[model samples]
Target chain A: MRKTFITAILLVLAAFTARAQTQEPEMADALRANGKIYVVVTVLATIFAGIIIFLVRLDRKMTKIEKNN
Target chain B: MRTWWWKILCILLVGYTVIAGFLIPVPRLDILNETIRNLYFHVPMWFTMIALFTASGIYAIKYLRSGRLQDDIYSAHYAITGIAFSVYGMLTGMEWAKFTWGEAWSNDPKQLGSAMCMLIYFAYLVLRNGLKDEEKRAKISAVYNIFAYALMIPLIFILPRMVDSLHPGNGGNPAFKQYDLDSNMRLVFYPAVTGWMLLGFWMATLRIRLHLYRFKKENSFAFENN
Candidate 1:
């Protein structure tokens, strides 16, 4: 158990070191760099619109059963 | 008899989940990059898990008030579903953490809190299993569910933010505040939360219907035999 605990600590240290060494890429900046995230956002919006259509039905069914005995 | 609107809606939701779940490329992040998009699955699983347990708690209370077996059955079904989602959530979170947090395990407040929440529900199941009488089982499980639900809030939300966190959004790490998070991600994220929640309920409802049917069948058979 002691060995396992020590290993866990060492591993966490390794991750911090890696993050410090590597220049992290910011997604917002990258999307701004490429200028495509807005379009991607629009696509995601349309997909969720489809999901709402499906869920409303299920909600109505649940309400119906709850209403009846 | 004819509720075309819901039918139409369900088709759209399924199509959206499938398309958004797979089609859109995950956005890039600094620390985790596009890999973080797995939040779409990982986060929602816990959200649904919470909703299921909250919902079960309500039914368990109702059973105590009304002496209805059906309410107890509903509680059981939802508790089971919550456990299933918790398993999926923990697995996905572990995978996400390994890649992003740089390790497979940590005692970080968020990590520990989530684990605690899973244990509370697992205990709820154990309470039910230990009882032989149906009435006793409902009473015992209902009491357990109430306490479990009460404990879950502080464990998942309040405590995690109180201390150091290896997880983003904690540990003074300047994670996404509501406004800082991408509006585009919210577009998929909010619907994803709702969609999975409804689907979780759909699973519970199917189980409830099957239970009701079996109950009725047994009663009819008893009557005929008598």
Candidate 2:
């Protein structure tokens, strides 16, 4: 599972870089130049990751309680 | 974990959405510019919110028919989840509006309608908290849930389109079918909607399980005391 996850991440990165090389569409080009878009992406990813991790931990706690019962 | 495939699918689809939404090419249009990409993010919130509330309404009907506590729990959680999505939708929409529409609150018909819909659901939450008796709470809230949802459909969907509004596909603004028909935006749009809806369901399920667990524990404790 870990291996597949790494591979998927790599594939997405590869696809991203490939697209970057092609004709870029009309976007916030200046924003992309300074790599600030990554800031937005990182913030979004972190928020979601935090939420998912919290939910998973809650699920685990519930499971332990159920087991005890 | 029992039905994990769809959960995994949700993660993948949303991950794709975040990445492609920023980097992917979008059709260039006047006024919207790069903000057009908000379509993938903003629009899906409304779709997911509607989907969740629909489920809430269905469960409300089931609770009324079966008189089952679990059904009421499910109905309540779904409404809560729907409210979460709607709140997020409104905030994001306001942000998008500030950039495009020149004001945060433009008195748009769609905006007013959605605000009223959100308040109705908020009232549902308050109603639930006011009742102390479980059975009474369940029955009354179920009736309110059904009624609120009936009003919600027209408020968000129908009433917005009937009047002049800054929102797209309403009044004189071009609809998605006209503007987005030729773009590849639909590729990500559909998946984004599905992914967000699934995520909302996932959250609701977790809440439902947590509620059920607490109820069971309380029952067992009461049994021990007896």
> Cα lDDT of all candidates, in order?
0.75, 0.87
Candidate topping TM-score? 2
Give model 2's DockQ, 2 decimals.
0.19
Measured by TM-score, how close is model 1 to the native structure?
Answer: 0.72
- Error of model 1, residue B76, in angstroms: 1.0
Which parts of model 2 have CA positions greater than 4 angstroms off? A1-26, A32-39
lDDT string for model 2 (B26-118, tens) is: 776667879988888898999999999999999999999999898998999999999999999999999999999999999999999999999
Which runs of model 1 end up more than 4 angstroms from their true locations?
A1-69, B1-11, B21-27, B171-180, B222-226
The sequence of per-residue lDDT tens digits that candidate 2 reaches over residues A1-69 is: 999999999999999989875744456878889989889988888887787778667767766776777
Q: What is the DockQ of candidate 1?
A: 0.15
Question: Considering only chain A, what is the TM-score of each predicted structure?
Answer: 0.42, 0.57
Give the lDDT of residue B165 in candidate 1: 90
Residue A57, model 2: lDDT of 77
Query: What is residue B154's positional error in candidate 2, in angstroms?
Result: 0.9
